[model samples]
Target: MADQSSEEAARLHKFVDPVSYLSAFVSNGVRPDGRSCSTARNVTLNIGSISTANGSAMVKLGQTCVLAAVKMELSNPPLECPSRGYLVCNIDQSSSSLSEALSGPPTSEAQSLSQTLQDLLSRFVDCDDLILVESKLCWTVYVDVVCLCNSGNVWDACVLASTVALINTQVPAVNTDVELPLVSISSRRSLKLGTVPLAATFTIFKDKYCLLDPSREEELICDGTVSVIYFEDGGIAQITHAGKPLSSERLISMCKDGQTHTQTLYKLLNTVCT
Candidate 1:
């Protein structure tokens, strides 16, 4: 009898108005995933998973899995920024990643996500560190992010993977002498990344409730969302809100809540990366 009732409820949830269905759960101070409104899902980080790449990591935010790999390529520096290299970031999501079986070209959402990640990483990474010979040549760091599974809150998982992959990266040493710079694969050096950058996402339900690390189902029914990126140096890399309007006090509170998660991420990275 209990199993039958549970199955009927699940069916109703799928076909009924998602917001109304979700409201029933939220009113009780819990989400369908059994997490409280303010609680985020567990995050797991594994580094150096891809041996072929310069650096790599796999991060899972609950069930969402994202893999990030870094590759170093030598190229001429940009004319305007002659001393700095490039940090290229890309996000690739396949049919397996989504609940819906999407095929063919990359979706606009994926492109937008890639651009957002690129912007954030570019701001966090000191490109000058990649300089091999000032204006002449420099190492271009390519960060490729692939989504294996997107249960929910994939954005946070991607950020974690990208940052951790870069943390694990070791650039090859270049001998600047002679006609052309000679690269020594045997000699490599790790990047000097100061403070780690991390992000947290929240979904606003109704006008008052804020749900942290929302799952796919919750996101579908959310009224609005807030994404916070913390630099860990008393600075925010980015804060974006979508869906609905949020008040100043609520936004500030959400930012503070996000910071705590970011700090936790930094500590977790330190433990695994070191």
Candidate 2:
């Protein structure tokens, strides 16, 4: 009898107005996944999973998962920035993760997501640290990430994966001589990373509820999403959003909420490092 009732309710929630159904659940401080309104899904972080890459990490938040790998190569510095090397971040979402799969070329949404991640992450990484030699040769750190799943809170998952991967990365020593520089794979040196960067995503549903680390069902029915990126220096580096506009008061509260999570992430990373 209990199973039958539960199944019927689920069928009603699926076919009926999902927004209203979810709203009712939220107001009661319960979600379909059995978590409280403000609680986030489970997060699992694993590092150095890809042996071939210089560094690699994978982060799973509920059903959403992202894998990040770092590769370093010798390259000349840009003309304008002669002293610094490159810190590039490239992101790709698998077609299997899409709800309605598209044929032909890659979707514009995926391209836009990659560009957004690149812009936001560029500010947090210390590109100058990659410079082995001033102008002759430097390390180009390529951060390639692939989304294995996309249940929700993708931005936060990517941030977690990238940060962990960078922490695990090691650059080989370079020999600057003759015509060109040569890399000594035998002599690898770890990157000198400062405080790791962190991010938290807040979602607003309808015009009322503000959810933290929303799930796919909540994200789909939400009005907008605001992601706040926290820097090592105890300041927000970037705040980007999509969908409807959020109020100033709400945004401030969201930042505060995000800061708390940033602290938690730092603690988790510290454990990994040790």
Candidate 3:
């Protein structure tokens, strides 16, 4: 396949000469894929792909693709936050991924990625918006993410998919005016999303070349990775970093780049949803 050949070539290119591979970015002001340091990949959001799920979406960020499905279930509220609902995110990446870095069972890296993603997304989406019966009954939105391709920037893809799927989710309306221990359910209803969140990911190569939406090959050779989330109004929600430490200046630069990416993705998702 052309994709396989490209990955193979990228791997061989990096393997043969790490210095040259990294230098290509600094000297050329572009990556092997011909993208600028702060340019994100093309992102496409597809909604209602899974008919069985209450809501589902697939996001293709370049070669990285992730599927997110939202399942709504009426359940008792947590004692701590009885008045608010919650979103649970679980990510499952199969062992047979596209690259060597991801071709394995659920590793600690994957688990940590899942947790961090859930945490980042949690701040963007408000569970309080899903409350139907305040203290007694609230909807729990289970966001299940599956990574179908691992070209790179899976975090952004997952977030994009989850957000779009949630916006498309339709929660049935419930009538609490019925007799004791009985509730009437209206099967046809939809949730009104309060805020839309957009995300952008960056990978720092050798602590100098900060590439946006790095491919799997780029990630393997990169020093570290960071992802930033922004609300629809362009306000930042969360910033996550891993691998080589980043300086304050670098963090600020990444945030600035994230703003531009946020606007682009916001427009893209809005267009799709509309």
User: Native-vs-model 1 lDDT?
Assistant: 0.87
Model 1 lDDT tens row, 50-79? 999999999988888999999999999999
Model 3, stretches more than 4 Å misplaced? 1-12, 98-105, 179-187, 243-248
Task: Judge candidate 3 at residue 172 and give its lDDT.
Answer: 68
Residue lDDT tens for model 3, 150-226? 88888788888888898888776677666533434446666666577777888888778888888887887778888
Worst 10 residues of 2 by lDDT: 97-106
> Better model by lDDT, 1 or 2?
1
* TM-score: model 1 vs. ground truth: 0.93
lDDT of 2 by residue, 144-215 (tens): 988889998887898889888988998888778756677788998787666567888878887777788888
Top-scoring candidate (TM-score):
1
Measured against the true structure, the TM-scores of the candidates, in listed sequence, are 0.93, 0.91, 0.84
**Backbone clashes under 3 angstroms, per model:** 0, 0, 1
State how far residue 206 of model 2 sits from its true place (Å). Answer: 1.1
